[model samples]
Target: MIEAVSLTKRYGNTVAVDNLSFSVKPGKVTGFLGPNGAGKSTTMRMALGLDNPTSGQIRIDGKIYQDLKYPLRKVGALVDPRWVHPNRSARAHLAWMARSNRIQAKRIDEVLDAVGLTAVAGKRVGGFSLGMSQRLGIASALLGDPEILMFDEPVNGLDPEGILWIRNLMHRLADEGRTVFVSSHLLSEMALTASELVVIGRGKLISQSTTDEFVARASDDAVRVRSPHLQRLRGALTDAGATVHEVDDAIIVSGMDSANIGETAAAHNVVLHELSPQQGSLEQAFMQITGDSVQYHSDLDEAPGQVLASGTN
Candidate 1:
């Protein structure tokens, strides 16, 4: 497991990470989420001891990263895929990492094949595309078969196929009882990939919970009711202490479930065409929770199609 106890970091006058604390357990995929400039990268850096914390501490299995007998064997990370030397071949790069950690050279081929880079093992990293570079970085991370793994935007430049590959790979690693912590801006993908979430904003911890719990807490219990007797049903629902709103000919009832709405309508002799519960999506919940923390905003009032046409000569 990985634990952060009030981890903090500063760069001169600016605070990069602020007293953040969280734990990552084995056999689960934990997604680290935040908006741009949210200090996610800095927190990950502190976890790996790449940057010393201004105050507080982070421990990997009860030991500081710098004190590990073989750090790579205990924790593997892919914070920046571009950290490799441009002039080195993918095979050479892994070989160097293996040598530094006193890992066997035979593990190089195993990891290369594990990440689907065997065919391009001899190719120079400078010539590799972003997706290929990401694969190579993952291969390097797996070189030691560590018990803990961390990745930052592992699917950044990947196509659909590559994205699916990385997602499955993370799941497999976690199933093998490794601690997997990943950070990404893709909320939809994170929803599908992560079992737990650690959310932060502006260098502070916002939430730490299971994926389902986080979504449920951020969402309101709402039911969608459609009926010809819109007026009567609305009155009955409101009288029952439910908030009602109309949207596109449908009545949205909150503070109640579908079963309650149906029963309420039946007792009032109001016919119902449809009654469905509307659970908030991860994307919707994320937007609601991080609305104020978003550092970037777009001012375009029109749709993208309209904006593009207006800009055309």
Candidate 2:
């Protein structure tokens, strides 16, 4: 397991990571989430000992990363895929990392094949595409055959097939009782990949819980109702203090439950055709929970034509 206790980092007058604390347990994929410039990269770098924490510490298992006997053999990470020497072949890069950690040279081939880079193992990393470079980085992370793996944007340049491959690989590793922690901007993919989430904003811990719980807590309970007596039902729902939104042939009701909405319709003598509860998605939950936490806000409220017309003057 990976644990952090009051981890903090600073750069001159700027604070990159605050007194944050969280734990990632074994046998589960924990997603690290935050808006842009939220100190996620700094936190991950601190965990790997690449950046010194201003105060407190982050640990792999029970020991600091620098104190590990063979850090690579215990915790594997792919924070920056391009950290490799561009002049070296993919095979050579993995071989060098393996030697540093006393890993067997033959393990290089195994990981290369595991990441689907066996065919291009001899190619210079400088000429490889971003997707291929990502694969090589993944291969390097697996070179040590570590018990814990951490990846930052592992699927950044991957195609659909590659994305699915990495997703399944993380699951397989976690199933084997290894700790898997990853960070990504692909909220949809994270929803499908991570069973648990550690969300942060402005260098502080926002939430740490199972994926289902986080979504449920941030999302409101809403029901979509369709009735033949749409006008009467709308009035009745509004009178009952339910916020309603009309979309085509249906009305979305919030601040009330499905059973109560059905009862309200019945009491109003409204004939209902459909009544379905809407489940909140990960994207919706993230936006709602982290709305205020975003460091930069984009104003897309103005229509394109309106903005163009205003600019013409």
Best by TM-score: 2
Over 4 Å off, model 1: 239-241, 246-249, 301-313
Q: Give the C-alpha miss distance for residue 269 in model 2, angstroms.
A: 2.3
- Which candidate has the highest lDDT of all? 2
Q: On residues 1-313, what C-alpha lDDT tens digit does candidate 2 reach at each position?
A: 9999999998998787899999999999999999887889999999999999999899999998999989889999998888888899999898888889999999998999999999998989999998998998899888898999999999989999999999999999999999999999999999999999999988999999999999999888899998889999999999999999999989999999999999999998889999999999999999999988787554557554333221110
- Tens digit of lDDT per residue, candidate 1, span 154-199? 9988999999999999999999999999999898999989999999
lDDT per model vs. reference: 0.90, 0.92
Model 2 lDDT-worst window of ten: 304-313
Q: TM-score per candidate, in order?
A: 0.91, 0.95
Clashes of each: 0, 0
Cα displacement (Å) at residue 52, model 1:
1.0
Q: How many backbone clashes does candidate 2 have?
A: 0
Instruction: List ranges where model 2 is wrong by over 4 Å.
Output: 302-313
